[model samples]
Target: MFKFTLKRFGYMLLTLFIASSITFMLIHAMPGDPLAVAARKLPEQIKANYYAKYGLNKPLLTQYGLFVKNAVKGDLGQSLASPGRDITETIMKHAPISARIGGQGLILGVTIGILLGIVAAFKRGKWPDYLVMFIAIVGISVPSFVVASLLQFFFTVKLTWLPTTGWGEFKHTILPTIALSLSPIATYARYMRANCLDVIGQDYIITAKAKGVSNVSLVFKHVIRNAILPAITLLGPQVAGIFTGSFVVESIFSIPGLGQYFVSAITDRDYTMIMGQSIFVSALFIVALFLVDIIYGLVDPRIRVSSGKR
Candidate 1:
């Protein structure tokens, strides 16, 4: 187990480094100048001094090396647009904003999705099954932005029951949460339902039924337990995905989240903010994939044993 964990951790580190490097190169490759962005906000003399002070005149390779070094030492440099604040601090402030919405939305959406899927699969061809599948289709079809707008229109504008934007109260999160979580929920449901139906046909299930287990208990103990294993495998990857997808949801709903900062960082050409956000996002994914690897053991011991075998 320890060996497996170490290997996964190593892989995650490598992946994160590659991702950050790509982001840095892509941002550097864009036409125009990072210094020019500062020049527009600062006087020519001030801009020249700023560029020299920060070594902006250095080669791109040098800048990339310095970036990796500074990042390792927890120095994200200074913000060009939003001066006088540490980029790390600026990003941390927005973490909770995004985390709040994504976390709750994940919980609510996953719960509903798994339940609907299991029910639909177990009762295949029935009215309830068809209805659940239909809703999953609708959830799959509608894009998050469109769903967000429609939700705002109906719940906030027409009914005036929920806030259209912001992160002050629970009401404010209603529309954004629903919009962000819909696709994943639908995705999980379809996958879970298909997997569950397959599990029901396995030899073990046939033996359990032949042994005269009650239907209710069979559904819970045997069926659900086996069916949910695959979903557990997906949890870690999905958590990282949730954070990334929240970028759009946050923009539409005007919620003050990390996603908002990410967009603003790009538009404002705040290199510090961009780097900080990029690193943090990369870290989230690395940690999530690591956790997912460990979770594989908890979900099914055979995975743990197989990893040990190598």
Candidate 2:
């Protein structure tokens, strides 16, 4: 287990490095200057001073090196769009909002999804199963942005049951949370249903049933325990995706989250903001995957053994 964990940690570091490097190169390669729009009316001397201050006048390789060095020291530099605003500070201020919404969405979605799947599997071929499957299909097919729009129209505009947009009270979060959760709900339901069906059909399950094991005991002790493993594998990536916030969802709902800033940064050519956000999200995703790998080993020791051997 120790060896497996160490190996995964090393891989995480390597992946983060590669991701940051790619982000830096790609942002630099993009057309238009980060300061061009804002500084266009300035004198040549002032423009030169501005470029020098931000190290935009430096060569790409030098800037990349400085970025890596500063990032290592926990300094992500300033936002080009909002001059003098520290990128790291911006993240610190906004990340909690995104986390709150994402966390609620993930918990609500996964819990409902797992329950729906279990019911469907237990009532295979019945109306319950059909209904669950139908919900899953529709949820999966519809994009979160579209879901957000419909939710806004129905709940806020038409029904007046929820606020249209903003971030303050609990009511503000409900619509966005639901929008974010639908796809995850759909995803987990399918995975859980499939895994549950497979587990139910196993010879061990059949033998236990033949011995007249209580349905509740059989499900808790045998069915869910074994069936939930695959879902655990999916949890890491799902958490990363949701926790980082959805670009379109944040935009549509006008939530002040890191995702919203990220979108605007792209259009405004805020190089540091873009790089900072990309690195932060990539690191989060890598760390989540690392934790999942460790969890996978703990849940199934055979995985640790196999991984260690390799």
Best by lDDT: 2
TM-score of 1: 0.92
Best by TM-score: 2
Q: Candidate 2: which stretches are off by over 4 Å? A: 243-245
Q: How many pairs collide in each candidate, listed in order?
A: 0, 0
Model 1 lDDT tens row, 96-197: 888888887788778988988999998899998898888899888988889888998999899998888777888888788888778778877887898899
Model 2's lDDT to the true fold? Answer: 0.89
* Cα TM-score per model: 0.92, 0.95
Model 1 clash pairs are none
Models, CA RMSD each: 2.1, 1.5
TM-score of 2: 0.95
In angstroms, the error of model 1 at 80 is: 2.1
Candidate 2 lowest-lDDT run of ten: 239-248
* Candidate 2 C-alpha lDDT tens digits along 234-303: 8888878875547688888888888878888888888899899889888888888889899888888999
lDDT of each: 0.82, 0.89
